[model samples]
Target: MSRSQRPIVAFLYDFDKTLCTTDMEDYAFIPSLGMTPAEFWPEANGFGRENRMDGILAYMYTMIRESEKRGLPFTRADLVEKGREIVLFPGVQDWFGRINAFGETQGVQVEHYVISSGLREIIEGSAISGAFKEIYASEFYYDAAGRPVWPKLTVNFTAKTQFVYRINKGVLDVSNDRDLNASMPDDSKRVPFTNMIYIGDGLSDVPCMKMMRAYGGQAIAVYQESNRSGVEDLLAKGRVDFIFPADYSEGTELDRTAKNILRRMAISDALAEENQEQLRAIGRDELPNQARLF
Candidate 1:
């Protein structure tokens, strides 16, 4: 189907804590290197401090450095293998289908996306990878030997918001920044900001959360018991529209809220479409004297 034809509602997610309990790397890859999270992070952070490198790049570099020292093959395939072992939070496995079916009932197409700073290979290896229309995340470039050698892309907090615009413009290709930056009328856009829903964890999500508020989109913050205080502060400050537990189980608060948001967006879109049709249907004879559409 053409991009303009479908009334699309996008659910953009932050993968790590929002979709799963902990960071994806912490789940399997770090342990594979025989260093605890505590030992590994400080070393990675120290390397960043010493080199003045970006934190995301520092971590990506650390992944390659540690893998080589351990004599482990650091290919895209290797990270994906580690991804398979990563555990997900409650009911995440079934969440997408349930949400998609709910969207169908609302007469809108629900498109899922992952906009993360995590490794793309790891995310690609994830069990839930198939759920997303696109995964915008950090990725490594392969050498001639097809081994991951350098960071091809690193999507930090600020970088993530660009993908949101890409989705809005229907310019899915990451290389196409020209069209994304081009000024298009609100009505010409593929997905209106009001039709987008961003789901993220905590601090790092602030940029996109604020973006949603500035635009017409909605942002939802999900948290665990340990991070409930942080999420509450976000709510108190009005950085996000709502906060819910990361639970995606059937009929849970998160699921229910998502459905309601979808319902509202669908109704809003349908009303807008009806108004547009009526305006287009108005004849030259009916313009000034008599009102045909009431």
Candidate 2:
């Protein structure tokens, strides 16, 4: 098949732990509160437990509340600026382009997406943000003065599943488009489940990993070398299609797995198309009535 005729592979990644070493907020925001991650996280969790607030919302609220107490600006720009300092795992900067180019060689289109609970503004400001086709993540609301006032969207584990549907339907807006989300036929969706590849880490990604795998998509559970036990557990539980080191460096396990998956997906797509064409040819030659349907 020609390059233009190749199928598109959707590479969906969970950002916090899968792509980066730590949560974006903990990198700068939590420390800026003059508290350790241990100290700040427990307070956030306490608020969630007491008020029944969503954990993500509680964290965002804590960020704003603490910033005010410290006389620091809680502006969206401030958060984004802090995001710029958040470091990525090895080879992340070149991973996207490398994978995209590799996909071309395999006769596939590679599109990257971020399905994360991290701050959208922060991710947008990160060095590797431009590689993604869409960023489905938490975001904050701003006041008239452009200062962040409250959490606008608090993406959680289950909420992450909605992004898979959004990617399928090509819907970017989180609001005001109910029918497309509710009524689109599965075949009419832009990216089929079989062409999706999800990369994630830890329990926070269980919902997404399970959903993608259940729907014929592939899910990879990634972990640091020290977390081999956790990676093994995910594989044993059959929560992912594969497991590998979090490293994205070229020639690493992750890089090899990803390239192989893309190649296989392309082959599968080509075989399906070939089978369809054969069926059409058979219909044209032997069944006049069925030929019309083709």
lDDT of 1 by residue, 1-294 (tens): 222665899999999999988888998889989988898999998999999999999998998898888898677778888899778889899999999999989889999999999988898888999999999999999988779877888999898889889999999998888898899866677877788999998999899989888887899999999999999999999999999998999989999999999998888777666655666578422122122111
lDDT of each: 0.87, 0.83
Total clashes for model 2: 0
Candidate 2: list runs displaced more than 4 Å: 1-5, 282-294
- Please provide, for model 2 over 1-294, each residue's C-alpha lDDT reduced to its tens digit, 9 standing for 90 to 100: 232566778999999878998888888877877878888889888998899988989888888787788888678887788888888999899999999999989878899999998899999889998999889899998998889876788889898998888887777678846855478755456787888999998888999899888877899988887777987899999998899877899999889988988888888777666656677768743222222211
lDDT of 2: 0.83
Candidate achieving the largest lDDT: 1
TM-score versus the correct structure, for each prediction: 0.93, 0.91
